[model samples]
Target: MSHSIAIIGASGYTGAELIRLLATHPSFEIKALAANSKAGQSLGAVFPHLRHLDLPDLVTWEEIDFDAIDLCFCALPHKTSQEVISKLPKTVKIVDLSADFRLRDPEDYRKWYGNAHGATEMQEEAVYGLTEFYREAIAEARLVAGTGCNAATGQYILRPLIERDLIDLDEIILDLQCGVSGAGRSLKENLLHAELSEGTNAYAVGGTHRHLGEFDQEFSALAGRPVEIQFTPHLGPFNRGILATAYVRGEAEAVLEALQQAYAEEPFVVVLPMGETPSTHHVRGSNFVHIGVVADRRPGRVIVVAALDNLCKGSSGQALQNANLMLGVDETAGLMLAPCFP
Candidate 1:
């Protein structure tokens, strides 16, 4: 049984990444590719790298026949996704790659995104698509919301420890560095190669990053208390990947054991050997997430580092992982490509 799929906002980085992975999927077919500005253009015109595949010409979302599409992957921007997805057919199973539905509380959405959620009903129904933690829920959901790249990397390292009460929640701090692509395909003066290359700097500093909402929501829910961590994000010169280093107060061995046990059955998460750290280069361009735990020189302190492709495991790959459950296909299908290395 082939599932006919539509990808909205198919001209961006994440949208192109979804096409890259889904192009090889055995049970899924790309039926519609929508990009309002790029409508009527061939997909290859906007994304030359994808020219090798046969794909639908870019169309406006309004021109799509949702009734014929079994699934939809909404890769639009934050506010845009909410507006577009609200108008989509109810029968379509959607995996949204935007922040529109990731947070549960509408108030939280407003606080972070600076506007009222356009689609509260769908917001209430969206399952958080952090595949490992929300598997069963995602498998049954009609709309699954993908997690933020930085949020995904940080959660992979801390969720298990928080769940088992292995770490001191009060003292946790997440310092993450991400490639420029995670900022999306939009053009900004600061993102220009002349400005960003050969240099890196932190933005959204002092607990100001938007992904803190996710950290607060997920970590607090797991610990059954109000948990807040100091989060700071930096933009690196590279093109892809995220490396999140979490400073935690706990026994190193215990942290390693907790992560290993929690992700033991997960197909995409790998807990590297104790004391060995992971590098973003190792997990580049793949759906796999690599986590490493090591002891800090100070007693009872440890550093947990997690690495993954910001676009893959952090967004598109995770969207597909949830889609597999929603479509009742093997979770690892079309996602077995090995990490690229130079």
Candidate 2:
């Protein structure tokens, strides 16, 4: 029952996370690890925390034998992922953790990423990797595109409301606070310890954040019309989770009822009791989502909030969930670990 696996961009945060989770997977075997720049280095040298695991030394993608691999996870940067993935053998199934294939249309890709897509044909075949809603499509597809962490957080709170016709499409506003890790493992002056600690600031204000494209595509499709929402994202001082609060015009009782119904059978999504909200601390390091709904003092105003690990459920964990479906294995395998708490 072992499914051979390989990981490109194995030196990145999402790549490290995939390795961490797969270490305990009963049916997945890590056959190869690729990180071009870090090629010839042991995975331990790249990530000391994983130094204890017996894994392959890093190698360039070209050195790996695709014939021996069942599936591959690509954790490269946006434009780079499409370029590398396009050259990979079609025989290998792929789970891409990049912004490259999330937007199905080539035009939308250009609008958000500011570059023409390198692989439009493959984009057409890739399924959006929101395991809860696109479960069936993912099971049958060869490539699955992981959503933006911000996008996934917002959707978890808003999708059901939109699907059940319970909210005003034009009046949705999502305010999110994301841990510094969501920005990736890359180095930047703004992310320095002195500059980022003990403070919070909002970035991508006024609807310019790229994840809005996902919100537009997904919500519009569910509503059968054009739907646009105001989204503002903030950078928090911590290092692991995302807390997204959505403001919408709807009846609290109905909104809560719809969310409960939508996730009633979903293993990873938890709908809290009415008037009860969730905290990022409760869902950190796990592939679980906690959602809460509350009625505002002003009637007809409803606030829905959701929390989850950006690196886990928001990206790598989500990729693994879809990979299990694509591989015909149990959907929850290796992913039911309880959230890490204080």
Candidate 3:
């Protein structure tokens, strides 16, 4: 029997991507969709791209009877997500695509987000949903907190090296180029086509971006100390990917070997040959992540590059992957399609 599911915030990009993936999943059925503002409208009306799928019309959250849902994907915004998720029935599994429960400490959540965590008790059991590194814990978790797209891409490049103690942590730097969609479906003067297209500008410069909190938490926890990296994200003219270039103090060969050994058997992460760099176009619209490494001309320096679709392996695709593990289904199910190319 197919596991029945509910998708809250179905009108957004990540939510729509979840519907796109779950539409073809063999053992999952989307039984409800909630987009309060778009309530009573057909999914087709909100997102014409998904018009062909036989999906439930968007409804308000209060209208759904949670008893029928075997799993739920909470794609709502930060504060909103915690509020809604706190009210869910404990029996239903949840995969939260927001930043609400990603941090293990309520104090860190408050320090970074500037507000108290609405669901402090819930944070106690929310597994970090990076999939590859947290697979075992995710399989046993009822609530999984999805990592930020930028955070995930950077981790794919740095986590292994940190785990192996192969790199100088104090000198790590991550420079990222991200798609505008990572900003979300909301309206912003800067995101307008006429303004964003044909141009590239760096936001979150000088270390103020919210995703830095995730990096600090994950990397620090891995290194058994506070490890901070200089991170700056540039908004590219493209629509759906993140390309991160990390500069670390390590030998090129050692960095390559660490990355290769870590993700060799993983289904979703691929490491390119030494000296070869990956492009966002290669992993666009797919659940795959491609990583590359190169030795800098200066001794004791190396560069690692990682690319992935911000919407896929980054957010919604990640949420679906965690949902699969929680449901005891194949981790690759409904997410094995090849990337879209020109």
Candidate 4:
């Protein structure tokens, strides 16, 4: 009853994450790993932490016999994801961990990502992969597009509030701090330990963060108008987790009730008691998202916070969740492992 799986772009952090999570999954088999740059190299050579597993040796995408795979996790970079996924066979389902297909409109994709979408034909069918809101669509989708890690954290706090009219959509502000892993396993001068450690600075200020495209799309769709929240993301001095603090205009009690009611049945989302905000460390290394809400000293104002491992709940964890639904397996499979705490 096990399903064969392939990970395209398996040399990246997210690819290794998928391997770690699926290692314990009862129904998924890691059949192939495609990382052209590291092709023919064993996984251990690229990621020593994963050296203990008996996983497939790294290979180029063209080398994989796609027919043997039932699902493919496209962890490729944004511009390249659509191009690679376009060639995948119809028999295989895909969970793409990139910004390529998250935006439904080709124009929006180009605007945010600075390139024309390569797989325009697939846009209409690629479901947005925020599992909680798009569960039904993802369950039947052949392709699911994963949301940005920062975007996911913000939505976990804002979506239900928007839906219930519990907050002023136009007045929302999100200040997020995320670990380096969200930048992927690429070599960049800024990500260097000496340069990045012991310091925190904001990037994608104003309405410029690409994930805003997702927020504008989903929140606007929910509110039936363009809802643009003030979002600012910071590179935290850590290896994992994202903590997003949002300021909003609403009754604290109502916002709390709405969030609790929305996620009361959700397995991964935890709504903390009023006045208690979540820290990134609380949910580190797990597929859990901790959300908290509190009233500000000013009336009609509230503060909301959310935390999760950028690599886990925000990315691969979500991809795996959607894959489970697409494959008709238990949604929580391979995702139930508890958070790694001190």
- Model 1 ranges with Cα > 4 A deviation: none
User: In model 2, where do residues sit more than 4 Å from their true spots?
Assistant: none
List, residue by residue over 1-342, the lDDT tens digit for candidate 3. 689999999999999999999989999999999999999999999999999998889999999999999999999999999999999999999999999998998998998899999789999989999999999999999999999999999999999999999999999999999999999999999999999999999997899998999999999999999999999999999999999999999999999999999999999999999999999999998999999999999999999999999999999999999999999999999999899996
Write the residue-wise lDDT of candidate 4 on 185-256 in tens digits: 989999999999989999989889899999999999999998988888999999999999999999999999
User: For model 2, how does the per-residue alpha-carbon lDDT over 72-120 read when each residue is reduced to its tens digit?
Assistant: 9999999999999999998999999999999999999999999999899
> Which residue runs of candidate 4 sit more than 4 Å off their true CA positions?
none
lDDT of each: 0.95, 0.96, 0.95, 0.93
> TM-score of each candidate?
0.99, 0.99, 0.99, 0.99
What are the clashing pairs of model 1? none
Candidate 4 worst ten-residue window by lDDT:
116-125
Q: Write the per-residue lDDT of candidate 1 for residues 1-342, one digit (tens) a residue.
A: 999999999999999999999999999999999999999999889999999998889999999999999999999999999999999888999999999999999999999999999899999999999999999999999999999999999999999999999989899988999999999998899999999999999999988788999999999999999999999899999999999999999999999989999989988999999889999999999999999999999999999999999999999999999999999999998999999996
After superposing candidate 3, which stretches have Cα over 4 Å from the reference?
none
- Candidate achieving higher lDDT, 1 or 4: 1
State the lDDT at 40 in candidate 4. 86
Model 3 CA lDDT for position 166: 96
Q: Over all chains combined, what TM-score does candidate 2 have? A: 0.99
Worst 10 residues of 3 by lDDT: 202-211
